[model samples]
Target: MITAQKREESLQDVPIAVSAFSGAALERAQIENPQDIQFSIPNAVLVGNDRFTLRGIGNNAISSTADNGTQTFFNGATVALSPQDEFYDLERVEVLRGPQGTLYGRNTTGGAVNVITKRPTSQLEGFAFGQAGNFDSVKLQGAINLPMGERVRQRFAGYWLKRDGYTENLATGNGIDGREQFGVRSTTEVDLPWAVTGRLTLQYFEEDSSRARETKRLCKAIAVLGCSPNELGFDSPNTSAVIMQTLLRSPIFTGIFPPGGDIYAGAPNPQDLRKIAADYDPKTEGENFIGVLDLSKTLGSLTFTSLTSYSEGKSKASTDWDNADLPFRFLRPITYQLGPDRQVTTDRLLTIDQFTSRSRTWSQELRLVSDNDGLFNYTAGAFFFDSKGRSRFEIWHPAIEFFTRAIGLPAASQHVDNDTPYSRTKAWALFGESYFQVTDATKLTVGLRYTDEEKAIRTRSIVLAAPTPYVVAERDWQEWTGKVSLDHRLDLSFTDETLLYASVARGYKGGGLNPGNAVDPDFEPETVMAYEVGAKNQLLGRALQANLAAFYYDYTDLQLGQRIGANAVTANADAKIWGLEGEFLWRPTENWLFDSNLSYLNTEIGEFLTIDAANPAQSLTTRTPAVPVNLAGNELPYAPAFKVKIGGQYSFGVGDWTGTLRADLTWQDEFYAREFNTPNDRIDGWALADLQARLVRDDGRLELQAFVKNVTAEDNIVSSIIEDALIGSYRNVRLLEPRTFGASILVRY
Candidate 1:
């Protein structure tokens, strides 16, 4: 069963295309993190850790105030932080494809992911699990359920994970991309009077780990000898001269290398994919607290439900934007006397970027759902949400302080630039859906939602000697989206059950401000009109299952990210997408199971003109303008044309223990990382294989397992991005994890 439609229903009976995975299924698939779900689900892609794409629609906005095209939910509540830490202690995960604006209001233009946690039962039960893997990885997880009298129940779950970094920092002699995380959750369920029930849950999570390192794939220093041309058949351009000139003046670089020496000496070897040359071995730290309350009461044939949630989190990070030990330039204003005249000059200082942010969100939802037994059933709901966030970004130049002290002058201010931006969002929505039985075998459903949202931001810069005025921006948006679907059950002699359905839906994502932008700071909302047809079948005495879906989307006013100087802003674009997906499961025998899935996607962008931020005329020094480029007939980012996965499992008996062996192989087609479709933005397709072996006691009280992922150790690039012109125009690529082998033990009581 799944809750893709905000109610309990058999996976095969739902008209929507959804992939559901139980807790046991996750364990078998070795899906230890949210990003792993992309391999198992059709037409779903996760970029980096926070960006998700479905079909061909995705959000690439770098601004914190921008909304995502895809949204995630935890126990019917929208998640405000990264969903990675919530993978543990889950009852099931449901990936819903296509637009879900009818039931899920905003920020669902691509799709929705629902994570449901295990509920407490009126019995005492507990389990403990431990695992150890390569790279000095260790993990421990446990959960306990307790019953307090006949009217109350509670459950507690916690997890701790630590792992060594996968990437090595050559300059700092330290490791990067490591993980150290801890999380705990508590849930309580109480039976109230008058057939009312309430469930309260609280969760806390923290992470203190090394930040991921990016591999530099391109350099823009034309003056440097031995520099090679990139895949675009272009050598370093004159735009890099300004950055090189600043580096030559920095005492920090002069002390290390000869004056006017090779600036590319700190670049990492291109042949080594897992090594980086960053002077700063930065760390990322974050903490989050979440609370949720759910209440429900049944009267007659209708059920009333209320859901409330609150969340707050803070994060700090420092990143090596250059991906090399190169100096970052920061302009400092100074005054000097020349020929008895006062002259003002700007000096370029070496600096590093640091970031800190905090956010809080609260939401409430009230709804009524009628039983599905009647010919006419309906659901109605109202939702309210509010969120606030603040971020502080600074460029600190330690070298400036050192240089000033050496010259017998007042210590230079460490901060060359400091920006603090505060953002807030308030939204409310009303929605209703109804189902009608047109015939004994045919059903028709329709849903509608109205959403009103407001977003605002205030930006302040503290670099100037005098106080600067805050830059404020605000915008409001209203949208009406809905879905209509018709499904029929076929009376077939050869199959147990078969369902055919067709749907048309519309999705919406609200637009927001670009805090510091002086021109066109506000962007327009994006919307998509989707059409789909699907079939779900159960055959061979319910031992075989097959599902197929075909969909087309008309996307308009698509939000796209771009860099204007040092600030990230959003722009509007248009696109069209179509895809076909298929899923199959077969159980040939009691001990054998086979499953496979395939997806084919096609995407094309409508004609639009935008600045090519990666190849500016003159970068850092002068903040030169960038040339505009036309993007037409270009494929969408992260939209693999072809993807397939095949897996099989076999079980056998070994005395008092049951043994199982499983293997899976997945292949994906090449895709681009940007709208430009340049050769440097393309990522080659790759295939991976995973194997697992399991042994369990006959009574199911104990289990042991061994697993290996990426058996071939393929060096695949998972994500890539082009740095802004201010950073010297380079491509940063993130590689997939290398081969890992691990063993696990589980105990139940």
Candidate 2:
């Protein structure tokens, strides 16, 4: 039986540009995190900093303020609005592209990602499974669906994953990247007569891992004289800068060694690095509480739905690596916590940390979905929200000589910051669509939305080393956004599922301050007028379905990450992106199934105000190039250019026994950075394969299955980094999990 649902009412009727992946598809692919979605979903890209850019809307460098170009929402509430929450048990993921300010009511200037968790189903069932694999990797998962009779029901699910490091730490005997995650999510639902539903969900995650491996810097081999590698040495207090130059995978980086590279001067391997190391390491913990009360009723011509939700979360994240050399222009003393200035003979480099916010939010939405069956269909909604958040960071460079000598420098330096504000955002919108009767072969959709917002901020600063003590300030701002789009279908004679569409949507992304020492008025919000054309179709007796869309995004105020002197700033740049995304699935011959997805994005910033490569580590050849001049024009990171997935499964019965075999492989093209500035930074894409076999009993009595991932032990990095060679796990590259195999079983009475 094909119990899976292929299409949703939202897909067939909503005028908004969007796409979604069912939890079934996610489970089949063993996608544990949001990044894993990149393989099957199109356009959606996950870059180096765990940042997301839908249709190229977000910036790679994220900050403490809303100035970021992209925003993320969970269950109608904003998650990325602050970064207080983490990815947890999700039932459905919706990616809405364009300005959704009308409904989302938060920082949704660009678009929003809605993660809806599965409510308690009125059923009683539960299952537990465990998997063990190579490299001491193990995963255990369980879920229970319970109906407490009367008016109550609940669903609980959890998983724990522990794995050894993926990258080798030459400095320590152990590998780098070792990690462990334990999380549980519970949802309770109360059903009442007269159309009212109350839901309470609590999710907790405690993840301890050695993350953010350091990067190895590359120096210019101008000559064997002063600035060469020998100037620095690799021993005791240091290593000779000379011999270290030979360790580079590509000798070419030496040629572009700009002036900043001089900071390493006579030091060996002036770059900071991340490696596999044995250290008590840094740990991260996070949690979320999402509460909702929903009320809905249907009248003759209208359906009214009211939703109110409150969410809260707190998180702490930190990572350590080997750092005997100075990482910044201002050399501070390095320490386990931070010494004045000397090589603290500790396990890892700096034991730094951050304690901040994310999920403090409350929202209310009232929506009406028209029940009229006339020639047009529509939906309208009103939303409101408010939030508060703060973050802290501490950094120490134990190896800097000025600090080791305790010359004039202080011990460890730290800063605590925050952005607390109250906002009133409103959106008014209407959408209408109709199946043209005249042509009987066409469908049309027209929708428009307008939004207004009021934003304010209170900044907090605490610096231990500064004599001026704590710094406090305040700021306020506001903006308005609008969007309009149209779609038409041409598959009247074929299938309603097979249609063509061309739409122009105006997207808005609000901007704000940089937080850590921002002096500017504020970054400007972004606006994009995107023109897209696409096709949705099915073939061969409706057993196959596909959707393809190509878009040209013209952006004003494109967001880019840069280092100007010691301050990290975000500015509006002008640029554009053109891309293609498509997906297809074929289940021909009942017993076999094949599926594939392809995506290509050519994105770049045309006019950047200036190129301030002043981050102690790098210096682009030009000093602040002209805005809109195209920086590399490379495929956005986290988004591979091309991807394909092919798989098939067969099932048969022998007497009273049933068995099945399924296998899938994912492949992508070789992807590298536009420029090489660090080690453990590039990857030539490779294929990952998985196989599964199951034994089942016809009575729904018992079942068992075996599975494996990365059957080829492929070593790859899904993220990029600017790593120096001396540190561990600080290499900048976030490695993909290596090969592993495991099995699972289930029993139901």
Candidate 3:
């Protein structure tokens, strides 16, 4: 049974394509966070920190007022932002792969991910676990539950994890992509009179980590260096500096690497993967505080529920822009106005870039649900959300002037840019869903939601010698979306556990104002109409279970990102997609189980026209390349044509212990990283294998496990960034972890 439909029902009865994982399954699969869970789900991927994509649709807008197409929920309340916390002491994680806007609220055009935490128990319970792994990785987790009197209970859970970087930096003789993080959660539950219950949870998490390592992959030769692109190596400062200087002289480097190849000095060679020549290691730090409250009361077969939540998050990061260990600079005199007078100064070798953001959000929801025994069952809810945030980004370098007198300006003109942006968002929605039992073997379901949202943005850009400010922009959006479906129980002679369902749903995502771009600061809302048909069945005396679904989507006003000049701009487009998904589970014996999931998707850009922000006069469609090139006929980015995952688990009994072995393999078809559909955009598909072994005491008090992930050591690309051909084109790819082995021990009382 599952709660994906906002009601307790058999998984086979729901008309949605979903993947459910129990805490034990998560542990066995070695899934620790959102980024790790994607490997187990077909047609799903998480890229670039928080960009979660399902099928062929994703939202990558940088505007604070915008929301992700795939919404994430923690304990029935919206996470509001990225929910990438460590997965410890969790009950389960449910992933719905189709539009769920009706029940999940806003920003669910692609899908929804819900993380359910373990609740306080009425009896005393506790567990402790520890792990050690390669790269000097260490992890610790523990949880305790306490019962106070007969009506009160409390639970506390926390985890601490640390690991050394996998990528080596030759400049400092140290590692760069290391990870360090910790989190804690406390929960309190109370039973009141009149069948009322209340619960509150508070959580705090902090992360201090380095940037995801990226290496440059050349597609064209560098004429200035007198060598083919594949012959270059970024492992040393001297070698990279020479290539950097040569590439800087290329005419295509004008707006991209104007000063020279100095910015790419730290990028490592694709073949080496581990070694990079950088002056400084890029570091990122984050902190999050969250609180959630739930109150529910039952009265005469009716239940009312209220959920409230508040959260605050802050992060700061510093990066070495040039990536090289050497100082690469070509001094140039530029004139600017300081105060009321004109000044001149020579540009220095820009090096370090810093970025910081702080945000807070508050939300409340109320719901009324009717008991399911009646001929009709229904749930209605209202939600309100508000958020505010500010961010600062700056870049500068250290340099001493020797010819400041020759240029007419001061030597302290090292600030490349200083930008501060602010954003505010307010939204509210009313939604309801009802199920009607039309016949003994048939049922009908309908749902609707109405949402209203408002957004405001302000951007401030400051240069070393000039101040440029953009006008504050504000926008409001409203939408109405809903779903309808029919489900029928099949009467087969062999088994009664079969269901056929068909559904059509409309989902909506509100629009927002862009901060960095002044030419076109507003984008449109996204809307999708999806049609799906599916069958769920259990055969062979309930030993074999299978579910299949086919779906088509009409998606419009999709929010996509593209690099224009030095900034990234959000654009709207339309697309069409059709796909098929199937999941199978078989347990022929009491101790053996096998499972598999497969998906096939085909998508195309229907209408994608873009305006050149750098040149307002150019209006080029996605099918016609005028500025950033068109992508009208191109396949959607990140949507592989085929995906497969298969696994098997076996449990055996020993004299005084129980042993289990599990293994899984996932394969994906090649896909593109961008909309341009060029050779550089392609990311060839690959396969990964994972294996685990565990042993538990007969008394169930202690357990031990060992796991090996990516056993094949596949160094496949997960994401990439490509510059324009006119801007010294280059491809920077982020590769997956090679191979990792770990072991852990757990004790329970």
lDDT comparing candidate 1 with the true structure: 0.79
Clash pairs detected, candidate 3: 263-322, 265-323, 265-324, 266-323, 266-324, 622-630, 622-631
- Candidate 3 local lDDT, 1-749, one digit each (tens): 67798766778878788888889878767788776788778788776545789877667665656778888777888765344478889888888988998988778998988888899999899999999999899999999999998999999999998998877877778777788989999999999887889999888999888854354333343533212223323332233323234434554335434553454344444346566666668788999998899999988778899999998999887766545555443445433322112244535343556778999988999999888676798999999999889887765433212222233445333344434467888999999999899998899999999999999988755433334555588999899999999999999998648999999999888897766565767888999999999999999999998999999999888777766534557788888999999989899999998888899999888767663322312211113344544668888888899999999999999879999999989898999877766665778898989999999999988999999988988877778665322223345567777688999999999
What CA root-mean-square deviation does each model show from the true structure? Answer: 5.3, 7.6, 5.6
Name the weakest run of 10 consecutive residues (lDDT summed) in model 2: 1-10
Writing each residue's lDDT as its tens digit, candidate 2 over 188-207 gives 88876776666766666665
Ranking of all predicted structures according to TM-score, beginning with the best and ending with the worst: 1, 3, 2
Q: Cα miss at 524, model 2 (Å)?
A: 0.9
What's model 1's TM-score?
A: 0.91
TM-scores of all candidate predictions against the true structure? 0.91, 0.77, 0.88
**Model 3: how large is the Cα RMSD against the reference?**
5.6
lDDT of 1 by residue, 560-622 (tens): 887644556788889899999999999989999998899999999898788755554434455
Angstrom error at residue 77, model 2 = 3.7
